[model samples]
Target: MKQSLLAARYFNTTAEEAMDGLIASATPRQYLISVQDGTSLRVRIWSEIGLEEAQMGELLDWLRGVQGDIRSIQSGSTNAHDHASVVEKWVAERHGIADLFLEQLDPTTSSKADMEPELSLGVLGGRTVMISTNTLMFSRLQEGVFGLSIAQRGSYLIEQLRRA
Candidate 1:
């Protein structure tokens, strides 16, 4: 099997800015959205992605209307391990979906290093973060399908968020 290299980029931003940047650049419907009891929003955003600043504000306002406390963006930890741990929990829990599709898959069978580092974006503590353990922003190593270098998608995402 061709092993993927670990790649990641860290940024200090809000979920709205990050999501806006991602949605504007991403393919249609590649992302998924889940709201937790109208208290928190969980988006399974695609790695490859933005909206305009004004539109973004409006969209966030709508979310806030439905999900209270959506604007009190708190700061998140910069520690990568903490982020990884959060991912681990998410996988293990699978939000109660594991029994349906991943019944045979054991979360313990995979180590953090062994898992395919997926692209993820979220507000850790308060700050927004974008990361992919197996994507390279810049590298001479093996290129991905469609000529993408390691974390090419994630690299594009961070840049877009910063610009937004």
Candidate 2:
């Protein structure tokens, strides 16, 4: 399969260091970084023709693999139960979609943003599935030190499939 790297970097470090760190850790075929307040980086590990292709639907199927319920943080102290249920329902419905990817953007250092979740959808194939939200969450966690940068390194597989 032809693979390209997608990466995003943040922080004061050089893009080379961040890219190297990601490649060294994950060893993926492709990499892409969405750096905030810094230059981004990308690398292609493999090249080939006629790789197995996928449509938007197929991408969605992969996303659905990690679908599940999420407990929401309490809202007000007096109506905590009601708010929790409401938030839980909202989250569940949001994830119920066929082809969606969600990432809780939380920076370890701290930031004003309330760690809002980032979501994306793959919509080419007939069988759409949601990608692993946990994976996206973890990726964001790793980039926490870099501020609010968004990284979609593992999504290369999905992107390749889409191209196919």
Candidate 3:
């Protein structure tokens, strides 16, 4: 068995900015990127708000630039739920189906613990792209700001399944 290798790193930006930058520079082969928030405690208190639709569109456009076809955007965090709804509306308006993956987390928990590192992937018309996120920290590692760790985990998994 070939062990999967990950090229993970700590980014020096807010989670949103890191996500935006990754989406902007995405490649069709790169579907998911893990994000970590690396802001000071004070900055985090002020930057908890999520991204807007227009901002999402800008990010989507960036993804499209890299041959990425995003069918939907899902949020697994409470703070990002509203933003996910907004993005879903935008995608629906554009005739794309959007969904929020918020159900995966327990809502009763505090936002801090609930908003751990999340995994989201870009799908092209129902066909999932090869990508996913692992268990990781978002706030502490990234300083409570937006941070991202991109790896080819999905592709590796897919390849392994194919061989099996």
Candidate 4:
């Protein structure tokens, strides 16, 4: 298997800038979205483990496909549940999907913040990318600030990423 990734870096950028980078690099083949009550957004992006970013149009198309898949969600489907079978199916075919990372979020915590926006949940692969305003946070490694070297993560993290 390829190396696992650990992207817990912190970049001092605005939320919008963070999203821009995340969107540009994301190449989600399949994804699930879930909400609690009427609020809270969580999205789990499924893709190849070390997947490369698609070109602009390709990324846009890929996003459209994800949206299309999301629309197909059953009446009670969500990113966490209602898609257990589907999640299992995808993960089985793509072990690289285990490389889960967060983006466009306030890692200090998930609570809603002052003017800044946060992406409740984000799952991604490839090189680590993290954008944040807090300087006190971030655990760097040999790879870099956001680079967590999946090759070193424990089985628990990998299993948890797959399970989620």
After aligning candidate 3 to the native by TM-score, how far in Å is the CA of 48 from where it should be?
22
Q: For residues 104-134, what per-residue lDDT tens digits would candidate 2 score against the true structure? A: 2333425433443333322111221221232
Question: What's model 4's lDDT at 98?
Answer: 32
What ranges in model 2 sit over 4 Å off?
Answer: 1-54, 69-136, 140-164
Model 2 accuracy (lDDT, Cα): 0.27
lDDT of residue 140 for candidate 1: 13
Ranking by TM-score: 4, 3, 1, 2
Per-candidate TM-score against the hidden true structure: 0.19, 0.18, 0.23, 0.24
Question: Can you write out model 4's per-residue Cα lDDT over 35-113, one digit (the tens) per residue?
Answer: 3345433333433343444332333343344344334442223433333333333223222333433323233454433
lDDT of each: 0.27, 0.27, 0.27, 0.31
lDDT: the better of candidates 1 and 4: 4
Q: Against the correct fold, how does model 2 do in TM-score?
A: 0.18
Q: List the residue pairs that clash in candidate 4.
A: 4-150, 4-151, 5-150, 6-148, 9-146
Q: What lDDT is obtained when candidate 4 is compared to the true structure? A: 0.31
RMSD of 2: 17.3
lDDT of 3 by residue, 1-164 (tens): 11222322222132334344434543322112222354221101111224355634544454342222122221222233333232233222222322111112222446644443223333222222212245321211221122222232211110111124
Error of 1 at 43 (Å): 10
Instruction: Please estimate how well model 3 matches the true structure, expressed as its whole-model Cα lDDT.
Output: 0.27
Error of 2 at 60 (Å): 0.5
lDDT of 1 at 70: 13
